[model samples]
Target: MQRKVLVIEDSAVSMNLVTRLVQQAKLMPICAATLTEAKHLFSQSNPEEFLCAVVDYHLPDAPHGEAIDYAIASFVPTIVITGRLDEETRTHVLSKEVVDYIPKENTQVYDYLSRLLARMEKNKHIGVLVVDHMRSSRTSMASLLRRHNFETFEASSAQEGLDILHQRDNVQLIVTDFKVPDMNGTQFVAELRKSWPKEQLAIIGVSSGNSALLSARFIKSGANDFLQKPYCHEEFLVRIMQNVEYIENVETIRRAANSDYLTGLPNRRHFFYSVNHVARTSPALQSVALIDLDHFKRVNDQFGHDAGDKVLKEVAKLIANHFSDHNVSRFGGEEFCLYFANVAAEEVDKSLESFRRAVRERPIRHQQQDIPISASIGVTHQGRKNLDAMLAKADELLYRAKSSGRNQLQSDLLA
Candidate 1:
């Protein structure tokens, strides 16, 4: 389900800007220009659908922060925006347990609001580990993380933190105090690096001491960033967001590099990499199939390239679904490769036949035109040879399938 962010702004320009930003962040935005309109929108939608809200403190219908109060009462995390901020408004907004307040003095404030919305969307899926020897400090950090909608784990000592990391594989960010039992902050960070590298996970060290040397030591020990113990809420969140964003960016780049743009399947390089890893780890029998679309160029030449692309995407979807449990990749244009993790040689024929039947039955529909599609598949079960040798055998059979007749399945096991 898509999470919606409620935006209540009286200004048309700001409302449009904020809505665009929300959509750019890939979140659905429910916009209202007045407090009465907001109420109507809320009445029509489910409260649980909203992840958070960006509420302007002053609205034409409800002036003097009434919208903020109502949003808080509805139990939605809010980032309040106001044209001006004074002591009274600040105190009132904070007292209502709003996430943060931003003074809308310039264009940059809207950018800040956009960033806050982005963080709220991401925070729901990220897990942070808080490490501190003192119970008070640990609880404080955990509470803050929870308010930001992050999953949090607590550790009273450095060794316990490491143990938690070993147990919970999903921990992405770590916040540790400078003073910890069993191992100090610098040593703890150094030990964490032995297993989890900076790209995989991020660590932030916090120290109460005024010594600048502690910050340098933490960085030297592989911590991504450092924070002073007495830090403001905004500063803490900024550091955490920066590190988390970096880790996510690296993952996004890796996925883009390994994925096929047209079909959303793994590319040829990734397929080979996965095969090598499986060869090293698994001793069970596996099967590899090389698939080629029959008369694919004719589809492009007759129906045009766009129609051909639609056929390819539809065929890829069918193949992926038929072999949902296996590794599937687009080896190149109109050619796909599938790797079955574990299966007996006898069962390979039945599975490949099922896929062939499905492909034959389904037609690719594009621009009010239905195009028939078919494929020739060549499968080879593992033998006393390397992956490359097994793939060579499969390719050889694929050629036989094409030469004998199109839209058929040929297997080495049959030979």
Candidate 2:
């Protein structure tokens, strides 16, 4: 179900903007011009359906952030937007358990709000670890993280933090205090760095101690960022968001490098890397198949390159769904590859034949036209040999399959 965002704004222009932003984040926006209307709308629905509420600070019905309080009391995360840029107002808004507040002084703040909404939705899946010897400190930090929709894990010591990380693979960020029974913050960070690199995991060192050198020490020990003690809520959230985004941006780039631009399947280089890793296990039975789409060029010539691309994508989707348990890749234009491990030759042959029939039976629909497509596959069931050698045999067989006729399977076993 699409989650809802409760947008309580009195200004016509602002309400329109917030509603559009909520929709852009793939959320449904429930709008009300006043707090009373918001209450009536919210009462009619479940609070769990709301991702968060974007409330204007000075709603005519509740001018002093009463709506913010009401939303928080009702267990809905609230974000305050105000034209009041005074520090007093900022402090008052932050004092409440709201997610965060934005000053509606410029259009840029709305952009920030958009990003914040997106992060809140994404944070539901991202786990954050909080490590501190003091129970109060750990709870304080974890509570703040939870308010933003992050799955939070609490650890009282560095060792406990490490253990939690070992058990949970989804943890992406760690906030650690300098004082711990097992190790100092810098030592703990260094220990974590030995296993988790900066790109894969982010660690932020926070200290309330008066030592000025602590930040440098933590950074030198491989912490991604450092925060001083008694940090403001905004500063704390900003630091956490920056570190998390850094890790996420690196991951995005890594995935783009490994994926095919058109079909969104694993590319050839990634295929080789993955298959070689599996090959190192030396399975008793292994097979490699190279698949080439038959008459693929004719599709492009008859229709256009766009239709040809669509056909490739449709075939790629079928390959992914049919051979989900096997490693599959789209080797550049009109060709794909599959690696099967520990499967009998007969089973591999059966699977390939089934896949071939699936392709021949399904016509790709593009631009209101049905475009027929088929694949010629070459299989090599040479067990536990050089992957390149297997691929070479498969490619040779593939040539033969194309040579004899199209839409057929040729294998070295048959040869």
In angstroms, give how far residue 23 of model 1 lies from its true place.
3.9
What's the lDDT for residue 119 in model 1?
A: 85
What do the candidate models score in CA lDDT, each in turn?
Answer: 0.87, 0.93
Candidate 1 residue-wise lDDT, 286-401, digit = tens: 78899999999999998999999888888888878887877889999999998876678777778888888888898888888888888999989865578888889899989999
Q: Write the per-residue lDDT of candidate 2 for residues 77-109, one digit (tens) a residue.
A: 999999899999999999999899899899998
TM-score of each: 0.91, 0.97
The predictions' CA RMSDs to the true structure, in order, are 2.5, 1.4
- Which candidate ranks first by lDDT, i.e. highest? 2
Candidate 1 TM-score, C-alpha based: 0.91
User: Against the true structure, candidate 1 has what lDDT?
Assistant: 0.87
